[model samples]
Target: MPRETPMDQPLISPAQRAVADAFERMFELSRAQPAPDLAARLDRLSRLRALVQDNESRFEAAISADFGHRSQVETAIAETLFVLVEIKHATKHLKKWMAPRRVATALQFMPAKNRLIPQPLGVVGIISPWNYPLQLTLAPAIGALAAGNRVMIKPSELVPRFSALLQELIAAKFDAGEITVTGIEDEIAKSFASLPFDHLIFTGSTRIGRLVAEAAGRNLTPLTLELGGKSPVIIDRSADLDEAAARVAYAKLLNAGQTCIAPDYVLLPEGKVQEFADKLDGRMRGMYGTNPDNSDYTSIVSDRHYARLEALAADAAAKGAKIVQLAKPDDPAWKAKRKFPPTLVVGATPDMTIMQEEIFGPLLPIVGCKDAGEALSWINRHDRPLALYWFGKDAAARDEVLARTVSGGVTINDCLFHFTQVNQPMGGIGASGTGAYHGEWGFNNLSKLKPVFYRSPFNRLADLYPPYGTKIARLQKMLRFMS
Candidate 1:
């Protein structure tokens, strides 16, 4: 057999080799300059802010193309403007977030002081999903850069136009070793996840999240997963039915209910199920009009997703479930545009497919609950959700729900607003995800909080050396007694 040279090694393909080389280069750069000053970090953030501000229209158009008919207003509010707010928040608080914190010293080390210094964790890898592509990709990158870490982002290939635009923008603005974006195929995505990164963050479906977790585990890499699940909303008896219905309609219809934190189901007071459904139906029609094709309603991402949603609704209807569709069933425009109308599924039981899975579409199941206690009990029976929403005026019921159920975050009297608070952390717990991010929480998660102990240069403890004398024993006895 012919000898194989180092350059001709066949362990990995050319594309994989290129990715490996990029990660290596970035890692080396991070080691050489571990700590970046506040000004430098601010400069990077400023550039990102400018990128969004300068090309707002381009982003709106690209994302609209990816989603068939994603609204310009929705794109601006949810993606471009949202990311700008994140950058501004990080820039405003970067100095305080980067400062070393003082900790109290113990009695055993009276003359010493303890401090916690936050340091960069080298290269960070982020795998963002297709839904809200720009926000998910850049939001986490904001934290990684704010923490003085190099970032390599792998955006979903499903949104090719947006991904290409993002790749172009990033490549033009940043050095490859500092910040880079990759839009590779499935096999390459797996290779990207398996890289030995200092940390990794993934935002997508629970199934894909599990795969990413397993790959990261092989390298023992720390991860922050923002997986989706059946996030429920409780509409208490005291809630203003009209107002709650309006807010829920707006939230569940945004991006056609393609958000991870979008309310997956609603628990209403048993007897008022019909009343609540009527209000929701009216509100959805008012917001988006009777024809989804003529309104700003976004289509399902692809035919496969549309088929899945159709099948779920069909299965529910076949199982004797009542479906309240807001649009005309005979409309051919919806079929051609791949737009599924806002649907409300009532009498949804545990055995139905719609109730079993996370409905990342415009399908909401209205589950009846006897009271607040029944609602809380039902929530506890399932996996922890990314978010929870409570709508009502009863402070006691709200407090009870907050204290009893566990979720990544909560928004009272509204939906999807908790995720916009830059000061608070946004992440999932248990099946939904792990590790929180956003604002200082994001900075802390990406950085290593190393503790330092500064000891005074004195010989007061010389008598306590390992001489095993009676005097030493007496000193030890005195210390123990004092403690």
Candidate 2:
């Protein structure tokens, strides 16, 4: 097998001086209209399909080239098909999502009608991550479009090829001011954070999230931070061991464990840690093979990430944790491929770097817990993850974990399954994310609620006017105290 390699650096330099003048004036144009141009939006979506619909294989190849090992089927299935689905979903329910909702009218305002109108926030900035580039970027764009806001997107420079493809697609399909892909300078990312866009959505590490949030705050811009934490998967004694092993393997190893929602660590029942580890080892070999270079298993996104994982593994090893090599480190011939083995560390202490950090790689760590209760305590000690998975036959066990722990979402008996449901909310709590989007929730995230109160044209109820007398005051007091 050949040595793995990192993703190639961008051929196009991120603009240090972005064309802010055009973007600023575009913002002005948006403010003048203040309404979504749905017709223009439909045209763009139509063209998006035309641009890539027949060229699906090429898009998949572009992503695989960017990542060095993005599974072809998953790339097409996850990135392209999923975005297409989002487009269709947005197109169908967009009108309803944009419609004003009726609210209950109070007795004092009986002759008046109240509506909660969904309005578009002006311009939005989306900072997309390299992992799942197309899905993350396009999916959010769909939501923003449905919400009635024009947008500016900053695709992660890490996945340069895919980012380039997106820029080309947008430039050819839409007007630049409406939705242009600005390549972010390492500093431009921070500058974008400082912009006062009505809304910003960033998907990346919690470390960067802090900087983005702080910068966004300076300008009073609201943001949705899709940050990361160590998501955990627990294997209960009542669980089907084989099935649990398979699912856990799939969750953490998919996208080479680069998913923000990936299972960062695992809590296995005592006395079964070795068995689980052995099973996982064999399963990974079956999936990616004992040889990573030739295996369908993906490579790490970049050397920086590979080194981060290597340091974590080294740190854990130095601390006396047992290293379980599912596949030894990739061959040097594939060194430029950014390849690493699907490794696991056993007896991982809570203090280890691998346990503390989001292991966004093929490395998996197993910590032996006394029981499900102990597992919950272990997880409760850390920042809440975007997701949590517990496998068991006991209904009470499932409920206990769900009731005791706090996470963005939980998928009992399965891992990373929640994100597949397009209708479910996909943000975090505590640190993972504040808002969510996928289906209706995604549409809601990018929209604003503007309520309108209408008084009946022939209203004869003048009891609550400004010239209030004792009678009106008494009646108001009665209503206020009544319920």
Candidate 3:
């Protein structure tokens, strides 16, 4: 890490100087013309979605490269499906979501009726993270386009291949004036944040989310920061270890555990820690095979991430933590690949390096707590996470866990599935993140709710406006009564 840290960097960057200016010029020209008829906007969005659907395979290929062997079927079923599903749902409901909503008029404003119009914010900037890049970008774009605003997508540079491929795919379908995807250097991320946008949506690390918010603050731009925290998966003693392990492993292996909503770590019942670890190890190896690489399992993003995960794993091992090997690391399964095989740490404690950091890799850290209550307390001791998962048949136990532990979203008897619920808002709380977006919640976040008040020619209270006196006192009395 650079010693100069945060202040060492400059916020104004090449992307800001070149790509942003180009998009701004294009947006200006597009806005100067009459708004695309609502029908035309729909047509454009349709074309955009169709283009994505056409090149869906190509996007999967890029994501595969980013993951060093991400399953194409998984990509299609997960990432591509999310994008298309969101777009399809948005298209089906665009008219209804766009319809202006009316409100009941209070007797105080006798002649006035109320309307809440969803107006498109002029331009929206989306900064997507490396995990599930396609879904993040496409989901936000649907809202911007639906609300009649142009979009500039800044995909994570960590996944360069996917980022470049997305730029090319988007450029092939849309003009810079309508939507643009830019491949920017990592250094330019701060500058991207500095751009003046009506709304900005960022999904990434919590530390960087703060910096993005500050840069946006300079321009008073509203933002939706989707950051991450130590998302905990609690497995109660009363739960089925077999089913829990299978589902948790699925979530942990998805994108090689690179999802923002991926299970960060687990809290097991005391004394059951080793037993749970044993079962988890069996399931992971049984599902993925003895060799992780050749077993259709994916690897870490890059050598940097691999090394970081490796170091954390090594530190835990050196600190007397017992390593439960799910998939052997040295098996022919290891082809000098960046693959970090599924590993579990037993006898692990909060003081270990693996427990201290956000393990965004295939390693699972098991923390033993006396009970669900202890697990909930441990969770509360840290930053609130983006999501939490619980597995148990005990209804009261589950309810106690749910009622005590706060998270962006909760999944009962599952992991990372809360994010699959499309209709609800998805985001973090406190240090994890602020604001959320999914389905119509995303559309509303990207649009400006311009409240409209229409005053009729009849029963107008002109005196309440300026020449206030006894009339104001009488109006106040009526307001109190109405309240």
Instruction: Give candidate 3's TM-score.
Output: 0.92
lDDT (tens digit, per residue) of candidate 2 on 64-170: 88888788877877688888887877777766777779899876667789999877787888999989888888787778777777788888878888878778878
**Of the candidates numbered 1 and 3, which has the greater lDDT value?**
1
Better of 1 and 3 by TM-score: 1
> Could you give candidate 1's per-residue lDDT for residues 1-483 as a string of tens digits?
852222343436767677777887887798887488899899899988988899999998898888887888889999998999999999999999999999998776678789999999999999999999999999999999999999999889879899899989999888897799876666568788888899999999999999999998977899999999999999999999999999999999999999999999999889999999999999988888867556478877888888888898999999988999976333677867878889999978889999889999999999898877888888999999899999999999899899999999999999999999988999999899999889999999999999999887663566777766888888788789878
lDDT of 2 at 7: 15
Rank by lDDT (best first): 1, 3, 2
Estimate, for each residue in 89-165, the C-alpha lDDT of model 3 and write its tens digit. Answer: 77788888888898888877876789998877788889998877888778878877877888888888778888898
Model 3 scores a C-alpha lDDT of 0.80
lDDT of each: 0.89, 0.79, 0.80
In terms of lDDT, which candidate is strongest?
A: 1
> How high is the lDDT of residue 167 in model 1?
89
